[model samples]
Target: MLQLKLYYHAKPYLPWRFRMATRRFFAKRKRIRYSGSWPIDPPSGAVPDDWRGWPNGADFAFVLSHDVETQIGYNKLDELLEVEKQLGFRSVINFIPEGEYSVSERRIQELIERGFEVGVHGLYHDGKLYNNRATFESRAKRINRYLKQWGATGFRSPLMHHRLDWLHSLDIAYDSSTFDTDPFEPQPDGLGTIFPLWVERKIANPESLTANQENQISDRRSAISGGKSKKPNGYVELPYTLPQDSTLFLLLRESSNAIWKEKTAWIARQGGMVFLNTHPDYMDFKGNGNASSFPISYYADFLQHVKESYGGQYWHATPDRVASYFVGCGDR
Candidate 1:
């Protein structure tokens, strides 16, 4: 009621007031000056050039990331994995470390053996990482160590929740948490398209921390440093670009494969990365009793459509591979 009242009251003066306010805001802000430090001269050991180019033909890449949590049982994961295998696609599964749905080391190893990438999700799936820098850094380190132990090199933050500025501390080779579209589009500086962008890491000074906090510090600074420090090297960010499976099935109440196929085709023509994200917890047929059945059939059918439509032209790369390619490997 209060919001409605506020909206109604503001409607009268919105046209003039909103325009003037916007103009004043922009007019008062200083223009961002580039220091000629950007573009950083691509690295020597970057991934294969012409990575994005499907010289043979127009190729489509579908890198699936499954956010597996305790709420999603092992049986559901097995079923999802079966569907992926049927589609001939190896997906990257982001596993939580210490949550209800956390996977054991044995299970992680099994995923690795199965040609799937096991990326770090987080210690807990809570949305607390962005609460502050210190907490985020500590949690990142713990997650990184686990990934290292599991022989994984990719990461996707819990809930796709992130503060890109704070990601530099994580030692992972690539991060898959950036998004192209949201409830509204995300506005990141410089990189305008809904494509992968190399997250420029900044070197942190030891002197910046107190004695107690020094040991816990690592160099992952947020990508939004805005010239606060010199950029670090190697790490790349691959953002998820598309409606997540849960979003399609639950939020939009879409249970058809046609919508996904249409969306994928549209994104493919743009010649950019398209990340297909599905959660194991939501793919079950009857475990949760939330929906009528898991959307597994729809997902499998969607993959079949992609394969039939694109043929073998699409690059079947993992999240890490996608990141590496974006850095330089697959340059045109």
Candidate 2:
């Protein structure tokens, strides 16, 4: 309601161009300014040698994901998969089961068969998932059923609207709907760290966190920066780094990979996870297009950059794979 009202009634009156320019300008400055914010504390014993690395000693981690919103984006999945495979990258493509187009179970199966991951986006892009407790609980049941049908354990909210407190009701292993920082989302407060942290069960309990994602605990206070947080992992949260393709390319009018490269460098140094969310509907087929057009190669180029710069220093895992690493049956 607030978001729709803002986009409908207020956007026309607001100087959005000025805002985007200011945001784009500060985006870089913040990136530079907060380079120190991450690796949140000085070298500590809790730091793992491969903080970013994964099983068998990979250095850093990257989980590339695509949110399919329209038929155009949905149509591009095969090509996207080919592009990723050619570059040795496998991504998760989320779909709206009964939204946009009738996304069939067969298509999702095809994605899995192609060695790609499939997850839920939302039933509709209408932004009502969190309207009220009853509405959310009702919709969650359908979402959970679809999740089981797809055999998925990951989710990213439609339009990036999320409520961490309500997530325990979601049966996913982890979520990729958050950002280290993004100014364009409906509730745009960024969580500051690129590292994957457990959404502690107590914290996510409905009584613990308000329905408002913008005013949640992590939003109000820094989740990192102390000695190590003793919070237990209920489910994992892999933070997306770099703004989404739509934000940088179309909104901010960027035309290059400079921001991504800078972010990748910082994340690598800090040994943090990079969970990038791109839309299949928004990217292009060529590798050399401007960011304003979101060339297909923009993502490919970033993958290449990761390969060239960090190489084996990072673990290229799926969302479930990363979460599975943290969740294991103890005392087996």
Candidate 3:
């Protein structure tokens, strides 16, 4: 069936009650297989005991990324940057080149200047980028142009509306548009692994890609061409791990960082990637409320938990650095 990409952003503007009612409707269906909620080793299995930690002997890995969707969010970047910097953390900030926010070269440079990573969020972020083949083909060219202009090698589809086969055409190195366990996204399909994956001609199926669990992630990285040669043209895909604020703190109207803490531990135990996408637009400065209504210091607390629990055990790096680490392993 053709996926009718209704205005994807319309849900956020929905009446509060309607949003809650809809959440009630799909809550159970979304968890049928525990797709986005469960880690690589669900009840049916266990993480391979031979699992190795991240490079540098770090216990696990975490990558923080943000998608700038609105002007308020763009303006909120300074505050977020201050928080991350003050805490000794660096994150990749993705910007929409076109759409409600007009990202200028100056804004791009600001991110670059601050020692942060810059990534390309979809050109328009309108949810229609992949309504069909021709539409994506048309937009893909502009997206590539923006990639070069903005000097971005990472991409996260607007609202996470991704068509992997079509997305492969872009010359980016990695994409964080997929998830390991997320039920609230516009397109909620979990690729079933918590590590970076090679999305290319060789990787034709998700299960086959991860079914060989032993050395699964390392094996996949070895096959990535990263656009260096025509023999196997493809990109690495880093699955976003934690639930977005819109889904957890807003639509579901939860009030705590319990989920973040839980998932962080699971990813660590599995010794997998902990890539997260928390939008600045959805944050709540106040520390109390429906939580879904606001971030309310939830993000900060989550970071603190990571530092306290794992401390030097986890490799806290951006997605680009992780990608490089994987590629570097392959080169060795």
What lDDT tens digits, residue by residue, belong to model 2 across residues 15-126?
Answer: 8567566557766665466555432322311344334345666656888888888888888778888878988889888888777677777887887887788889977776
Please provide TM-scores, in order, for all candidate models, with all chains considered together. 0.71, 0.76, 0.82
TM-score of model 1 vs. true structure: 0.71
Q: Candidate 2 — which residues are off by over 4 angstroms?
A: 1-53, 203-233, 286-292, 329-332
The predicted structure with the larger TM-score, 2 or 3, is 3
Question: Candidate 3 lDDT, tens digit per residue, 1-332?
Answer: 14434445465577867756877578656655565345333531234343444788876788899999888788788888788887788899998888687888888887888879899998886678887788888888898899878877788998787788877657576888898766566676777777777666445454554434424333333434343322233567888877777777666556787878887787777677787788887675544454335863788888777777787888888777777666544422
- Please report, in order, the local distance difference test score of every candidate based on alpha carbons: 0.61, 0.69, 0.72
Model 3 TM-score, all chains together: 0.82
How much lDDT does candidate 2 score?
Answer: 0.69
Shift in Å, residue 324, candidate 3? 1.7
Who wins the lDDT comparison?
Answer: 3
Pick the TM-score winner: 3
What's the ranking of the predictions by TM-score, best on top? 3, 2, 1
TM-score, candidate number 2: 0.76
